[model samples]
Target: MSEPEEDLQEEQRDSTKKKKKKEKRSGKKKKQKEEREQEEAQQQVDEEEEERSECVVLRGIFKLGKKSHDVLLTRTRLTWIPITPETPTGEPCVLQPGVVLTAGRVRGEGEAAASGRPAVGGAVLGVALFCCRRRGRRLEEDTLHLHNASAEHTQTWYNTLKELLAGFSSRPRYLKVFINPSSHKKEAVHIYREHVAPLFKMADIRIDITVTERKGHALSVMKECKLDEYDGVVCVGGDGSVAELCHALVLRAQLDADSPEKPVKPVLPLGIIPAGSTDVVSCSVHGVRDPVTATLHIVLGHLQQVDMCSFLSQGQLVRFGFSAMFGFGGRSLARAEKKRWMPSSRRREYALVKTLARLRPEDCQLSFQPAKTSTGNLFEHRDEDQDVKQDPESEGEESWTTNQGLYLSISIMSIPCLSPHAPRGLAPNTSLANGSAALIAVGNTSRSEFIKHLKRYSSSSGQFSFSFVETHAVSAVRIRPSSLINWSEEESEEEGDSKTTPIIQSEGAAFPWNIDGELVEIANEVLVRVHPRLITLYGEEVDEAESTVSCSCI
Candidate 1:
């Protein structure tokens, strides 16, 4: 073969190899571009899926005010879009966001139709939607009306909305209500009828109400009534009424379980409507002592589990309470209970003044088991090592710390007991369902100093900043008064014998203890044990409470 022919063939082979490499590179680039586009499309679909609406129940056209609008209903929300006049039959011009459905209502007829007024824009059928509108910490009712020419569409929308609302499992369907007509100015019945009852009706919750006629009437009713028929229990009264209900519910649960040693959580949630002189539980739970706010919380099915304290005296269950006070508080309440003929406000003021005038310390022995998890104590005047001590009696068990002193007042609270007089709560360091209680001991101080400590509760902070005040987060506490000593019998020896024995009596001497605003006289030592998340209350958890109008009595 010729050298020129071989070189030409080689050049041809080189050209063919270069052309094949170029084609291969071009195919690779094209495939990479297609893969990128597919990935982008998949990502877009995933984003849309994340933002997708819940199952759509109904969709149609309705007249809102003077213009036509497109409405969409789903399991979670109710959305509406405005239709421009130029695009009457086309898609909506503006797509507005939907309103989340809470405790709302839907009716087949609108206000205009009910009032015999002509429908706006000459529409025939109408539907009204009543929804909850939140304004800061308050909730208000709002209504939206939609008019359509087709009755079948309006009726379908109403039915679909009703079914969706009914599907919410958290909201209560039936409630057993107890109204203490004698609670605080004798207006509990009126408050329930005027403010709370209407809201319950609006939410379509069935209620069986019992107007309490006496002090222990509600407790008796709670003991005998069948709680299984109701979804929740509601009390309309002061803290005393609420405390009664809490005790009754817990006692009933223990009895039903046949385990008095191990108490179980109540089967139902409790709702409080503030119609009392001092609505501490309501204020502490709802952040405000407003009846409407509490009612709205119940209607919305907001659940907050709270810790409760079981008070046992001499190995017998005294009661279940959220907060308790001994020493000065108990004495003041004892005085106030004796003055029932006076008006409630006047009686409280008189009690406060009289108690302050005769402020004396009680010699008592305090023992408590500190919580395992350290919830930092508020205004701790001593070091942690000094506060905790090993119990010699229980060698390997939990250590128990004992303190014996003359204390002006001893307070134990599982929840922040917010009230008009004490906006920061009697125990400001405590929280709901923390498995611990705030044990505050105010050591014996001067009258001025004690008054200053008491008045600081109305302020924001520094209520526990006093040197004499000490706070601890404890799981259990035992309080025994050292002053409960009485001489029962004394025997005189014969002439010249000169021998006499004195008999010390411990029983039959009852001391007043202010427990959840109810005065209970208990004998012997009281053991308070905290149960974590023992009961469910209808309200949201609050970290802080805003101050209300302070009382002038203090």
Candidate 2:
């Protein structure tokens, strides 16, 4: 804490940063060198190389650093040809969407321009055009000043430049956004005010904001709201609100379709901004929990189709989301939901302790058909391969595996459930829209062993290595509680002529069903069906090799 010590620590931190920067620079240089060598050996160009040979719309001198270049804006990429008599225009410096940072028009002061420079300044006087180009990890501003140009010519070139940049997106100018005020941390409004609104304004994206006042408010709004007026639906809240909006949107789309047999679903993408305690869906998709980055993705108009799982009880749709859980996972969420009014920091701990103390696994019968990828060591036992043959109802694709046992938890995750509780994600290998859901059945085990397994979730360790844990990639699953059913009978001999009825009550607790962190009614049986690519989201598809690093906006 002394001044000298503080100075030393600060100097050390700065030195470390410098070293990291130097290492990154060296790595980038090496990669570039290898890339150039490979290209030369193969005599091949990049994918968009041929596109640059098309008609050059605009051409002029532009300044990059101290040097000038004759730039050409083609249909696909930008080419900067250095103006020099000695050196040939060897692969004209090419730039696509990835390297171009900020592309806009410049005004005021004039900069000296040589023939090699592209027209940077485009409007009225000076170099009328400017763009920040990426140099390794950093961005460098490059301006072009037209040495001699008329006002009309400048305006024309600027418009053309804008058009070129706009080609990256489908050009969605308008969108409808819903903000849930009572969601996790109560910061959706503040998040929008501080980050989302400003970036959206700059992008020239018109957003109609609606701050929700009550629960189930978004559901009603989506039911009655116009579907074709905007480019996409933006939900800013926790998993509950986002899931609610999705449910309502999907229902409405089906309702409004002309043909009930085969409905025409809406292709409107949904954008999720994480402004809640648990943004599992958003985090799972984007690989981060930042609100601005999510908003930018919407503005960039990235499209991804997401799978949806519909939970139905007695043929009526209860709810639908990307993920759901039964038994202990459900009970734990229910206990947690009670203390949602408290701070997220305290609520999680409170929920965990309270739920564990009263935790009791319920005996239930599960019937599910295994997905193609689920036939592994776990299915080696094959308890009910004969059960499938005996049951006439479960014919063809309905190869149900019936099992009865006390289970701690049964989790059905369509998307990877990522949160502080499960940092590496609950179902880490679950696909985003792979036409399947991961069914994890945690059999009854000792409290200490269960806690030990739970602790492993916080780290990148083997949480599924427990002997009691079993997982299957299933397309459809049905859970039937052994002791959840109820029966009532009326006595024939009543007092005088009146008939009396007696209600039969079960002594045990029912396993709570958790659907997107919200509890459904205590039902004896529940059915889940996966719908592949049911709705489009403003995120990329779940690639098999999804990188942990921040993905570039493509």
What TM-score would every model get versus the actual structure?
0.80, 0.72
Deviation in Å, model 2, residue 350 alpha carbon: 1.0
Q: Return the lDDT, model 1, position 450.
A: 88
Q: Each candidate: what lDDT?
A: 0.77, 0.66
Task: Report the error of model 1 at residue 336, Å.
Answer: 0.7
What are the per-residue Cα lDDT tens digits for candidate 2 across 96-122?
211222222112121111112224454
Per-residue lDDT over 351-460 for candidate 1, one digit per residue giving the tens place of the 0 to 100 score: 89887766667767788888777565666574232233455644365777887766788899999898767777788778888889999988777788888888777755
List where candidate 1 sits over 4 angstroms from the true fold. 1-53, 84-98, 103-124, 382-389, 393-396, 485-507, 550-553
Q: Which structure among the candidates has the greatest lDDT?
A: 1
Clash number for candidate 1: 0
lDDT score, residue 26, model 2? 100
Q: Candidate 2 — which residues are off by over 4 angstroms? A: 1-55, 64-69, 79-98, 101-153, 165-171, 258-264, 372-391, 485-511, 541-554
